[model samples]
Target: MLDIGIIGASGYTGGELMRLLLSHPQARVELATSRRLMGQKVSATHTHLKDMVDIQFENPDPHEIKDRCDVVFVAVPHGTAMNIVPKILDDKVKVIDLSADYRLKPAVFEDVYGIKHLDPRNVVYGMPELHPEIKHEGFIANPGCFPTGATLAAAPLAQASMIDSVVFDSKTGVSGAGIEPSQASHYPNMAENVQPYKLTKHRHLPEFTQELQRLDKNLTNISFTPHIIPSVRGILTTAHIFTKGTLTKYDVMDLYTEMYQDKPFVRMMDGIPSLSAVKGSNFCDIGFEVDPRNNRVVVISAIDNLVKGASGQAIQNMNIMCGLDETTGLWVPGIAP
Candidate 1:
């Protein structure tokens, strides 16, 4: 069994990772670290795992973590992972950093994040459907939740280089904002209300731009606007993708099917996909319609913000990196209402 260690074990992503890894057949959580909650039971923070996971949170040195784990997931904030990851990478421990740390070119990362990238290197962007070759890599930079859903929605059209402009309007759960409470995520403000923030600029925008460009280098005009919804666990994205030429419904469907046919997590739906269908599962449900009059294809994509968007995807990357079947711990269906 692979010994896995998590750098930050108290946040939503970390808790979700612990819950998923506990049941993994080939890997187990060997170390869960939280400086403030050091020595506290992991279940104390993640109440649902009370009896299932018996490990306590321990704040161990990054260098020491290298010896304890064969694979490590750096689940800390944006700038923090760069610091810890560099220390642990020297001992041959495979790593997947779930932050915006290494997902872009050094210059692009600094531009989008507005912070100098202290450590920049070529790491596979961990979106399994787009880059299945992650199966052989030792380190991966997990994609952000919004980018995960948005990219899958537009990837097929983008790959064909048929897109002239794409507008992604994504509605995300409050949990994506993390454990820290904010005025935006407050119960009163978020309940019965939909507020759009970062309308013109969001950090995840760069990831969408960078990844899509790989499929077609001459593409431009990618816009993103994100809103916080009342829900607690999903992201539903509507991608308005403009095509360079007219295409029938049959044509669009054929493209997506051919692109995602080999990918297990990306499901092509006959009708529109709903959040409930992918809430707890490691699947991205995609559906689309061709608008002949407007020359646009409206694509809808749904994923659980914490699962397929984060922890579940992280584990998926781990399984691939370790040469286990990609669905080793994540083939279960989502809970639907």
Candidate 2:
């Protein structure tokens, strides 16, 4: 069994990784670290995993982790991962970082993050659907939540060179903001409200543009707008796409079906997908409608913000990296209301 270490295990992504890894059959949890919750029981921070994990939250020490784990999942914030990943790389421990630190090229990374990238050569952007070959390589930089959904929604069209400009309007849950409570995510402030933030400049913008461009160099323009809904989890991304050539709705659906036919996590639906359909699972349900009236197409996609957006995708990468079935330990059905 592959021994796994989770660095920065106090936040929602880290806790979710713990919950998922505990049940992973081919892997074992070796270490879980958190700076603030050091020495505290894992269950104390996330009560949902009370009986599942008896491990305590330890301090972030690369040496300690390198001694125990064959691979490490760095679930920390963006800039923080860059500081320690270089040292971990020296130990030859494979890493899957759920941060934007190394998602783009050094120039794009610096431009979007406004920070110089310390180690650009060692990391690969970790969007399994887009770059499945990267799994054979070592280090991975997991895509952002919004990029995960948006990219998946538009990838088929981009691959076919059928789309002109794509406009992504995504609605995400409060949990996407992270576990560190903020005023915008406060109960009263979020309840019964739909607020659109990060209108012009969101970090995920560069990621989406960069990834899509990899598929089609002519795919130049994208308008991505993200909103925070009152829900606790899940993301619903609606992409308003202008097709360059004539294509029927059925044709677009067939293209997606053919593209993701082998991908276990992607579910192509006949009707539009809702958040409830994908919550708590690794599945990304996609559906689309043809707007011949305006010669446009509306593509809808949904995924659990914490699952496909974070922990589940991370585990999927691990499965691929370890040469296990990608669907292993990810068979849970979506939780219904």
Top candidate when judged by lDDT against the true structure: 1
Clashes of 2: 0
Give the CA lDDT, 0 to 100, for residue 255 in model 2: 86
Q: What TM-score against the true fold does each predicted structure earn?
A: 0.98, 0.97
Give Cα distance to truth, residue 301, candidate 2, Å. 0.3
For each candidate, the alpha-carbon lDDT, in order, equals 0.92, 0.88
Give one clash count per candidate, in the order shown: 0, 0
lDDT of 1 by residue, 1-337 (tens): 9999999989999999988887788888999999999988999889999998899999988778998999999999988888888888863799999998999888888888788888888889999999978977889999999999999999999999899999999999999999999998999999999999999989999999999999989887999999999999999999999999898999999999999999999999999999999988999999998999989999999999999999999999999988899999899999988
lDDT: worst 10-residue window of model 2: 118-127
Question: In candidate 2, what are the lDDT values of residues 1-337, reduced to their tens digit?
Answer: 8999999888899889888887788888889898888899989999999988999988856677888898899988888888888888743688898988888888888888888888776466788887878767788888889999999999999999888899999999999999889988999999999999999788889888988998998998899889999999999999999998778877887889888999999998889898998888999999899998777989999999999999999999988887888888998889886
Please report, as a residue range, the 10-residue window in candidate 1 with the lowest summed lDDT: 83-92
